[model samples]
Target chain A: MSRTQRSLQLAAYADGEVAQAQRAAIEQELAKSPVALREVEDIRAQRAALHRVFIEASPTAELSERIQARIREDRQRASGRTWRIGLASAFAAAAVIMMSVRLIGPELWHQELVSPPPLVARALAVDAVLGAHRVCSTLSDGTAHDEFRVGQKSIVEANRILKALRAMPKEGAALPDLSESKYALSSACACALVSNCEVVHATYNSADGVTLSVWMSDRPLALSGASKLRRVSGEGGRVYQVAEVAGGYSIVQWDERLASVVLCGEMPADQLLKIADRIQPFGSAARPTVGPRVAIVEMALLRRS
Target chain B: MSGKSFEEIALPHLDVLYRYARRLTPDAHAAEDLVQDTYLKAYKAFGKFELREFGVRPWLLKILHNTFLNGEAKKKHAAHSTEPQVLDTARAAAEIGSVEGDLRIDLDGLDDEVKRALEQLSPDFRSILLLWASMELSYQEIAEILSVPIGTVMSRLHRARQQMMTLLADYKFRGRGEPPNGREAT
Candidate 1:
């Protein structure tokens, strides 16, 4: 090859991308020409210099969370559009199923059908979307078993409910203050999908009768079909996911290091996002522990936000 | 691929992507946004192919580069004038006799000079150079990311290194082990 052609091939040779025959040819050129040898050395130096200069910036943990958050936003927007398109069709199909089941099988039905089951068997078998579906449609009443009063005012009541569910005790982590929210505390429940996998459900109602429920558990509900599920880094570095159920409700689930939380209501996406943003687990009032490395990271990011 | 597994594979490269993105767009905020947009796009379009460790880096970087280029167009901002400014500075230095008798670089200032010399190259040359030097991607992989033939990668890499060397060759180092103080040798 000519000197110029050989020079072009030298980079590929240095990068180990050239074929054996071409590599041999380039090696010959390197041996024969001192100028070519110097060129190769210059290329090596340039590579080292570039590495030293360019790759120094270390990305913050916030950057990863932010990237994940953007991905979640993109996915939600897409799935939201899909669900909107299928909303009418889904409702019609659901109505048909409900009517046919009710009309055909009186003996097969029970009053318990109106209450949310201890477990969303099918939803748990599928993903979180279907989990949301089961919670929204079946758990319409939003009542915690009568012992823990639905409208408890303090952390003691929340502790009572948590004990009932056998949830891990998180010092200083309390229910988000919703007094100024459009919704007020109305009902709460301790429900489980399977024994030992307890989830505490707290329901709130607005004057207009629109209800919002929050479920807190030790672990995020793990269902079989998880493709319908996603983890999002919500505002303030809170990781959450929004799954729109068949009914007109959106369920936003998140993890607070201390607990897994789910917020569900029939509200617009923006409204739900706003509520999610407000539901901080470790606000100044709570005075949460800053011991764990994870908690420290979360607290720092949340405080910044 | 599932979101969990995709996160496992892709999240580790967040810093790598951010570093490249920062170089592509000098503005820090713009670089962050670019990285965010790149991940968003990559996640939406990601498939089983990206599950492979080898394939994911180039794939993610391709998205980042394309996003940066498109973003520049969208914002109608000049595609970072650091290069032109550096070239102009170099030219004006030559004209005003910035180099006294010889082309001498203060040993401490070699890094800054090398960096400025890099900025003096066009985006295409700078990008190709950085990909090879900083990321150490294979020629085939760089070609794939840039959507150019492997031969083109070879040529560009050669030209980029040559340009930098030409710009830098005249500088005589002050001495070894001194931190760059950005001063001209008297």
Candidate 2:
């Protein structure tokens, strides 16, 4: 075979779709021709390189946003252009089942919240869009359907709710705070182009060491610092660590100003300040650039919202 | 699926999505755009999402793949460019700077050449290869994305690689001993 034909054959060979006899022929050709062999090598390297460069590229947050928008549109369209059909499931089977629309009225709400229906209703309004059928629609109960709209006040309210939850005692005390922060923070991450940290502290004793992780990605952040501990004139000494991460870095500043460790990482300085500024610790006003308190408030607002 | 609550539910995938977008769309603005589109779509469509049962990587890839393919992008932006804008790739490159444990990578100057060559393939073929590498989607997911039979997805990917090899004839690779073809490595 000529060198040109051999090159094309090499392409086919790389893709693993080449026929058995054809592969034998290519092998025979490769044994004799130096150029044919090189062509085969070139093809392999290129494919691997492409994977390296693009395979790991971060996907757009817009895709999720678009899908969300599509769902909303679909919901609206369904309300208008109903997909009418005979009740196939019930009709085909020997059963007369009638699902009720009163499921979402009030009873189940009280059970899930462990509070009276009035409390949930007073906390925030819940709008459940029912998936309907022909004639009439059945309103089904949803797990968590609360929506948080955009606005500074909305964010502040969400934070307050998050703080209340986080303040609950030891076992999963952080759960409420963590859950609330996710909705609000993810929305922000979507708006901005990167991930943000929800919390960081030495939850572990000295033996357990320090754990730093990017809240969204959950990949452990690599913490390294020349001096892990330092001494202060009046407050004495404390331990601190700086962690390395992709796209940004995190520092457990371990600020002793409040006699409590202040965990601060990379964020828009002004917004971080806004979150930190309002915290009123024990006796003092809520301080800006305050990581733990902000974490507390952010989580609270998320739960309440 | 682990029933780890909302925080643990989707937290694991943030980095993989971020990394995939950075490489697929070379421009930071484009990459950022793609990442946001993927997540926003994922968030709204979370009700339909079932993790592990339906592969998370491929499912996410399908969304991202579709986003780049059908994303309501402006007509003004160029398809792909070679210019090295600092902030866009600086962070991504720095992240993949060294493969720590199990991950092995040799990412360098070859990305532009690959991107340029892949552009020549038909849009369908282009999406197939891009999704294959980025999302690490299997043949099945590619079929779902392009709306082709699984067999067709396989055949097209094979052909796409060949077409890319042919296109590489025009471009150049950074200082390397042999051609990109795997015959040497094999």
List the lowest-lDDT window of 10 residues for candidate 2 chain A. Answer: A126-135
Count backbone overlaps in model 2.
67
A261: Cα error in model 1, Å:
50
TM-score of chain B of 2: 0.60
Off by over 4 Å in 2: A1-42, A55-305, B5-9, B23-26, B52-54, B72-109, B119-123, B134-137, B172-186
Cα lDDT tens digits for candidate 2, A181-231: 222221111110012322211111112222111111111122222223232
DockQ for candidate 1: 0.19
Report the C-alpha displacement of residue A143, candidate 1, in angstroms.
47
* Chain A of candidate 2 compared with the true chain A, TM-score: 0.25
Candidate 2 residue B64 C-alpha distance from true site, Å: 1.5
- In model 1 chain A, the worst 10-residue window by lDDT is A136-145
Which pairs, if any, clash in model 1? Answer: A144-A189, B107-B174, B108-B180
**Candidate 2's residue-wise lDDT over B1-186, tens digit each?**
555532245446656656655555546677666666565555545554567555565666556655664332212112222121223334433432321111112325557767776655554556667666555455666676555677666655655655565455334322344443422222
Specify the highest-lDDT model's number.
Answer: 1
